[model samples]
Target: MKIVIFGGTGFVGLNLAEVLLARGHEVTLHDRSPLPPAAQRSLADYRERLKVVQGDITDAQGIDALMAQGCDAIVLGAAVTAGDDLERASPARVLEINVMAQIPILLAAIRHGVRRVINLSSASAYGAAGQRHRILDEETPCDPVSFYAISKFTSERSVARHAELFGGDFLSVRLSAVFGPWERPGSVRDTPSLQFQILAAFARGEPALLPAPGIKDWTYAPDVAEAVALLIEAERPRDRLYNISSGVAWSALQWGEAFAALHPGLECRLVSPGEKTVIKLHGGDRAPLSVRRMADEFGWRARRRAPCSGRS
Candidate 1:
């Protein structure tokens, strides 16, 4: 399979690219950043097997040229992630990069006969999860709370509309808290509240700030990459949207304990913030998508291995 990945130079992109390459699939990575030194060294052997296109997604001409290379599928992994000051920034620029930029790329792919498209969506689109509603599934109502979530949700709708109009294949994977190796510096690899507290304590050798109590269903990067590969290879794709997550919930305290277990002798005072109730989504008793569905349709399974190091 010849797969083109937008923003393939980042954490998730690199992991997915590695998985596809190992399976003997031709891979093309489109990104504006120069290939990181680590990735360049790691993928050196397969330099010819992989193509890197340096251009912004806003550049329609460049995207058209990339699509002209005859990609079998395109994975839209590019996005402006959260933590930005959305209020001060221009909303038009935000939409241009996150929503409008996809138009030309998807159009070009369709024009060039691309078979399928996989869009990366965020679990945050379901809004803050709380005690009453623990799990958010594909059918759940979207209550996006942040600009990033809004952009991702809008992009998913746009992709679906394009698929409906063109009679093409598309799937949006609503991903939960994802973390593993190769994460970029200061990237949101951990839950935001947890990350801030952990970094302050561990990296800066300062006391930890307790996170407001909440449960998150975290997914490992490798597991997510494998699931994506299987979704691409599925003979008959069923759901247009699937939750890519571990399906197990862990509290912030549990995460902190896990981290402390990993690195003993790391003594730091802990400060607990008063408990605050937040919306909890997608951590219910039943699996959002049954194992049978994945097995019968896409041949995917939850990886039951131990959590990756540095995670709780």
Candidate 2:
């Protein structure tokens, strides 16, 4: 299989590229930014299977030109993720990157007769609906609240519409709270998981004063990449939309306690929901996503986890 990822140089994209390459698929990473030195080194073993190219998904002409090279499938991994200051920032860019960007890419996929396409949608599309429902599934109605969530939902609709018009096979997978290796604070996203903050705090010898210890399902990035790879390789997808998550809602206290047990020295402190902290977090109720669909269709489930990494 020959696969091309639009935002392939980013954290999740890079991981997906590696996973696909491991599965014996040729991968091309198309991104505006150059591949990092660490990534280049990390994937050196599969260098022949991987091609790192430079292109911006927002540029329609560039996308057309790149799609000309041809690929077995395309994965739209390009999006500007929301950060801590999401409400007050990049309102236009959020819509532009997440919503508008998919138009040209899907059209080109149709033009080139690409076999399959996967849009890496976000679980945030559940939005406030999570507060209402216990578990989010493909059947759940999207109640997008944040700008990022709205864009993702809009893009999913756009992809489905394009697939219908072009007679294409496309799948949109809503990813959960993913955090793991090759993760970093970047221009696009910050480390949002309580597990990550606890690990980093312990490493820095700082108090893990996490904001709002509410329940949320956290998926490891590696597991996410693998699930996506399988979806990309699916000969006949059972559904157009699926949720890739841990499938279990874990409270902050539960995760923090696990972290403490792993590293007994550092304490996990939880600030009250209304209180202020270095990083603002929500202590609100959460809806865990069901992975039953993915499991039932592809025999897929996340085996790895959002593990605490600080060790002696």
TM-score per prediction, in order, is 0.83, 0.91
Best of the candidates, TM-score: 2
Model 2: residue 56 alpha-carbon error in angstroms: 1.8
Q: Per-residue CA lDDT of candidate 1, range 77-127, in tens?
A: 887665544423555655677788999988897899998899988776666
Question: Model 1: residues >4 Å from true position, as ranges?
Answer: 84-90, 128-132, 185-208, 268-296, 304-312
lDDT of each: 0.69, 0.81
Model 2 gets an lDDT of 0.81
Question: Which runs in model 2 stand beyond 4 Å of their true positions?
Answer: 272-276, 305-312
lDDT of 2 by residue, 214-290 (tens): 56787878889989988888789878998999887666656676777766687777876675556445335668899
